[model samples]
Target chain A: MANQPSIHAGVRALARLKKRRRSEAIFRAFGIAAIVFAMCALAWLLGSIIGTGYKAFYQHSLTLEVELTESILAPNGSRDPDTLRRANYRRIMQEAMFTRFPDIEGLSSADQRAAKRQNFDIMSTSGGPNYIRQMVFKDPAMVGQTITVRIPTSDIVDQYLKGNLNVDVPEVQRKISDRQIAWVKTLRQSGEIKAGFNKRLLFSTDSRDPELAGIASSFVGSLMTMFVTFLLAFPVGVGAAIWLDEFAPKNKAVDFIEININNLAAVPSIVFGLLGLAVLLNWAGMPRSAPIVGGIVLALRTFPTIIIATRSALRAVPPSIRDGALSVGASHVQAVFHHKLPMAAPGILTGSIIGMAQALGETAPLLMIGMVAFLTEIPSSLTEPATALPVQIYLWSDSAEQAWSERTSAAIIILLMVLVTMNGIAIWLRSRLEKRW
Target chain B: MTENTSKNIKFTCRDVRVSYSGKEAVKGIDIEIADRSVTAFIGPSGCGKSSFLRVFNRMNDTIPGCAVTGDIRMDGEDIYAPGLDPVLLRARVGMVFQKPNPFPKSIYDNVAYGPRIHGLAESKADLDEIVHNSLKRAGLWDEVKDRLKDSGTGLSGGQQQRLVIARAIAVSPEVILMDEPASALDPIATAKLEVLIEELKEKFCIVIVTHSMAQAARISQKTAFFHMGDLVEYDETDQIFTNPAELRTQDYIMGRTG
Candidate 1:
């Protein structure tokens, strides 16, 4: 020891110190690189989704002055509701298009018929006709008046106006013909056709026509299913956690139960969907594709997640708190319910919210339960047939239409927003309710 | 040393032993604690002083695989009798831990918890009176009277210990067990706690386990020395400190051995 050189600033020691600093710097660089990579990936995903999805929120529409002929709408001069509903609104729309372009009259009879058909294809068949029917049915006295009304164009025209469809492609391969394109451009130049917010996308339900599709039904279905999932999973999960962590005796049977619970959390979620299919749909004869069945399947998938989280949260409470309560002559139940459970509340709530978010995004299990059906009507009750948002997105993504592709991206954005909001609430609640102890 | 017996004995233990998962922590022992007096159990760490103290209120029962055997009677009633609920026994015999463990609740609620759970107070006014009197007896009323609504965990180490003691006394227990209650406090806090314990012995039988021999000498009237899961000696505090008959007790008090 006496012969050893001074440790500070020695050659070997300095080399060792330099090596240690270099290794630390390398580790820090790797960590920063990892984080930057994750951020870049997230940014790229969001950029692509927004680029395609923002166009689906708006559409092009033509403002037409339609002469609502009383003779065709109510030939008998009867202003009854059923008579007005059964009116020939389609002919009125066709004649209005014919009036806009009277050049069709100069062509041959066969050419005239073809040109008229191409002209009618410029407007949305369902949206425009349904709007005229609802309007005239509500106000029967306006039957003979010529009124200016805005009507959505076809999905192909809407796509072209949004600049998603390329005009440089050959005419044969393009969805829009040169004649229909010419009419659309003419109307746009005259300030008759304009791009506006797509109200149908938010208010209406699923439709074979992409211009009339909406998320209203699927959004409501997701809400109802999440409600049921929370109602069933939270109480049961927290109760089971309390019993296992605080009251259950440590024995072979309990150990086995605990092991199985952990294993259950890791099981494939679609297996739960199959269980629901066999027991709920086939055996119990519950309605297929109903939110109740969907909710129950999701509850089974989320239950073990909630249980694991709650057990860990309960374990996090220091043993001294339980001992303090017990020493004061509080019963085991009172000790757990009064002191420990309250302390574990924030953690349990955060876990439950995260689990619910996972259930919201889950699609595979929902598919097995027949929630992937193309439901058009919005469900009014738990037992009614419904489809969830993720399932709706999956269905739309599988469509062979460019408009459906944009709609699918938009639906994905909405689902992501809901998940982000739920996660945000979980973070906010954890911070707000967490105690220092 | 000559046996020092009290006519008003509160706890009588015969061949009492405690084990955890078949490993004995506290071997067979016999001891009697007098009512309305302070008895101190002093030994080195892990000598089973705390385990023996926990046995009085059945706190050890909460530990998995921990078992206590033999006869332990309180006021001539077998506390381990089949019909005697541990919950009721705990209310009658309260315990304070080595670390101050006040619940994360208002000061009033912390003290009112015991009485509220035992139904000792019937109304809000009754609960308030009980909390007030308990805190006053625990020597914490003057310091915390204005902050009854404040969280009990917000107090200092000394105050939290006193609040826990007040919580124990609120249920009107006949015996209070303290397991090294002042070991975590500073010198000044320890002095304050010793004074509070002195004042409390006038009403309830107090049993304490301490690592500090000087503290045991200063605050306890009777002393029990433990070593390697056995009680080496039990006598008057003055006799144990001055004229202990056992070699292990002498070595321990003389600071020659742990």
Candidate 2:
């Protein structure tokens, strides 16, 4: 110990002083600063999203009272074929609103005459109103009828309510008249003009306009895609993993397969999308925008992750357990599934959930497969055109309107919530399985 | 495989050779394990004692790239015959590992697993009885009576080892192969297992592999000494412990050494 260099060695001591404390402290400070910077950025993004998206929960609409007639809906009443189709939803919708709000039945003669208004309600749907569009266009008399309609306010009106409008706002640029503003106040006092939950937002058909768009059309698409991924990926992934981990002999072929699977798991999602488009959508001639095609794409992406996690779990089972099972008359399959697999369940389930969540939130591959199409109606089948939440967020975000920006942030919040929920479920399952230990 | 076959016939091996990927881990050998007796193989590290024990039930088949050849028979029938099902063979000959490998399951479930798989229990109540008797034979029932549903892995190391033995016995196998079953146990646990092994030999043939020469000398009626893939000596445990024949066995006994 005495042979070691002392602190009194002039230039060396100064260098040691700098090395011993300052450099390490500086590095630690840098690390802490980086962490704080990252946290701040995340907080800012979340804060702004929450602030803007909270407005999407409420919407502005105009309500008017007018009579609805059968001729407006079933024009030329002799049509047995058109009635066989779904009822004319638009004519029925106006009739329903008029029945609820009877004050708008008479025409206004003077400018000062106050018209009755109510908080408007509509079974708002998404892209291309399926039954309503067919009904409205089918009847010519429906166009000139004075039936009351509860219509979605424009983006400029929506902005005004969200506090984007000010007192200094120009008269020409203003979306609503002073009378319209007075009616909005009257509706507000009557408990009709405020923001409320948009229930159909997640399950309705698309509207031609953004005012009517909802996530429902896309939710069904996501469900179909996820179902496909679950059906295809779970069995194939787990089986391949069990065979590889428990039965297959140690060989170069298996080694190659393992490496390939690992690499496949890391392949970019967009690359998978392109593959799906070229192979599934074009060559195989599957439905262009079907959720089935989206599922196939996601399954290809999800399998590698499931296989890796499953293999590792199987490997974690002790050799003695295998030997014990074998010695007790359990076949390799019985041993793996009945004995070893039961032990590895927690891990396998965790992997499955992670894979499912990834598939659920995925967008790029779905986009490539045409799941990004502007679908307005709830998906009735796996082969139908639809969009997913993330893609909807992308669609909303790319729009010129600032209102859609808020909607996009709201969609992101929804997606994040879904992800967190799935992860929570996985954790719960893992803990349940781990209780054996 | 015939109906007239004797259940009590002992194992008779001739020129058995075991290899892993072309490397001879156990050289050609001859051995005979008597029925209903405690036969132990004793050797130093890497001397193939555990490998030889695995050969009895073809437990080596579980290992990738491992192969076994030569004759091994029980009840005057070739146990290694071509049509022999490894699963059925294992059912007849059970094993306990060096470390306590109680399944990550309840104590009751652990014992019931083997019987359930073999269809030995005809009903839920019968299954309960099998679990009870197996645990009783392993000498662990009274200690774990209050918590039969608790995980088997929750027991002390000695208790877990006993639970494993209980699981092995639940299937009513004809033979039980123990490979260093108490190697990881403390002195008191080792003594407990040794006494348990003695009691088990009454109903089933007990073959054990051990690194402790003193343990082999203490528990086994016959001891086979293996050295570097070779069976150097086989004799009564007393004789081998007292007066081994081969130079290697003699040197091993005299501590010249392993």
Which structure among the candidates has the greatest TM-score?
1
Docking quality category of candidate 2 according to DockQ thresholds: medium
- Please, what is the whole-model Cα lDDT of each candidate in the order they appear? 0.92, 0.78
Determine which window of 10 residues in candidate 2 chain B has minimal summed lDDT.
B1-10
Per-prediction backbone clash count: 0, 15
Write the residue-wise lDDT of candidate 1 on A327-437 in tens digits.
Answer: 999999999999998999889999999999999998888899898767788999999889999999999999988999999999999999999999999999999988866
- Give per-model CA RMSD: 2.0, 6.5
**lDDT for each residue of candidate 2 in A315-432, tens digit (9 for 90 to 100):** 8777777776777788888888877888888899899889999888887887888887887577888887877778888888888776777777777887888888989999999887
**What's chain A's TM-score in each predicted model?**
0.96, 0.76
Estimate, for each residue in B59-147, the C-alpha lDDT of model 1 and write its tens digit.
Answer: 99899999999899999999999999999999999999999999999999999999988899989999999999999999999999999
Stretches of candidate 2 off by over 4 Å are A1-37, A61-152, A166-192, B1-9, B254-256
Which residue pairs come into collision in candidate 1? Answer: none
